[model samples]
Target: MTVTFPHKTLPWLLIAPQLLVTLIFFLWPAGQAIEQAFYQEDAFGLSREFVALENFIELLQDPYYYNSIGVTLVFSMAVAVSGLSIALVLATMADRIIRGQMVYQTLLIWPYAVAPALAGVLWWILFDPAQGPIALWLEYMGIEWDHFVNGGDAMILVVIAATWKQISYNFLFFLAGLQAIPRSLIEAAAIDGAGPVRRFWDIVFPLLSPTAFFLLVMNIVYAFFETFGVIDATTAGGPGQSTKILVYKVYEDGFVGLDLGGSAAQSVILMMIVGLMTVVQFRFIERKVQY
Candidate 1:
């Protein structure tokens, strides 16, 4: 059955608010960034000169910019894989609980409610080399733990913080997907003498592929963009820029370094990278998804 709106104007009116918001918040800012990418502006923004692709050329040649790109790729992949993997495990465990499921799920989800910056701070405090219990314990175990000075440690800290924040979100979706799977299929697989691991690999996981793929894309996007707060709070791209992802580099250059044109160019490039990633995922990766 086809449901038609009585008036075309009404249909437009219903979407007007969303369209206006997108235009004002997203499209307008994107347009401004694209324009700024081509212009060289001073710190005071009092004078500007169009420089076409100079900012982009400088960035391409700068090794630090390339470092940031590599860091972002590693960070995004780590966060997405670890977050989804851990969440799947938690969701599977939670799915088997016959009691206290609400409490368990609630505790699992509580991390997601924490603000990103706050979560970063929480992890920072928990891993503080001087006083944090975890750091102290690691020290007791004869392993040095210090993110403040070690670049590898700093990267690990940011990755852990980012992944921890995303796990709850992945958990919610994984739980929903797990619940949506028919119980009869599992029962039949069990009757056929399949073990839990065999059933999961052969039947359950295939059905969950769609959910996993969606979470993969979301987690990558989250790690790329939403992790700025976590990095800013914890490492600030410090320990010799080991943890500085592309998004944080954009902020660092534009706001902190006062390189307006370069920062705008970075932002534009980041936008293009994300757009291309989304396209590639849907075009190629989605083929393996079951539903």
Candidate 2:
């Protein structure tokens, strides 16, 4: 029923369109960033000067840059861990529901469809110190909930927003993985006198490791780069740069500060960091992740 292209040249020709798209869209932009990183151009683009490694050197020397790195590391870990753990728990509970399973899945997954900025706004409104219901309740409890000036509070707010936004996505994957697992295994384990907790730990959890590992990597990457809109719409990396993650810093420096070279250098550095992290994950984590 299907036609096969046996010739290598034919296969290449068949995939040429996708290859061209990748080259034009991904490779070209990456190349431009690398080129721009080594050059400093005037704000107006009237003058351009080559300054090899100077931008990177300055970033290394800047204390704020280090602060951003620390903030990003903390933010990424918080987002990834919280999101994945909550999603997994929800998925497990959903799997057990004999009734209203579809309704529950739909309710859990609908949040992922919301735009990042909108999600951030929703959380922001919920935590707004002046009018937010949660904030009012916290105030009643004698805890002053103001992320405006408190660095730790700001970090927690952003982390909560990011984690909430990401949970729906991780939930989707985890639910799918749970569904794919054979029901026979759980039954057999029960027959072997394995209780619910033992059955889940020994059977279900092990089988879901692949999906969990994949979600872990994707969640980290999302927190690193994709949560820019969330941060921008909610905190704008403000409160004295308390929640200024690396990507937000890049945007602030390049677009607002007009430091094109510095931003490009930051972009390049981020690419390298992400690449190294992927490599490390695939090397070590992937081993523990069963197929």
Structural similarity to truth (TM-score) of each candidate? 0.96, 0.96
> In model 1, what lDDT does residue 282 have?
99
Q: Which pairs clash in the backbone of model 2?
A: none
Instruction: Give the per-residue lDDT digits (tens) of candidate 2, residues 1-291.
Output: 999867879878889999999999999999999999999998999999999999999999999898888889999999999999999999999999999999999999988888888888998999899999999999999999998888888889899888888999999999999999999999998999999999989999999999999998999899999999899999998788788999998898899999999999999999998999999999999998778
Looking at candidate 1, the ten consecutive residues that score lowest on lDDT are 3-12
- The C-alpha lDDT values of all candidates are 0.95, 0.93
Q: Worst 10-residue stretch by lDDT in candidate 2?
A: 4-13
Best-fitting candidate, scored by lDDT: 1
In model 1, pairs of residues that clash are none
Give the per-residue lDDT of model 1 (tens digit) for 1-291.
998767969889999999999999999999999999999989998999999999999999999889999999999999999999999999999999999999999999999999999999999999999999999999999999999999988888889999998999999999999999999999999999999999999998999999999999999999999999999998999988799899999998899999999999999999999999999999999999998
RMSD to native for every prediction?
1.5, 2.3
Give the clash count for each candidate.
0, 0
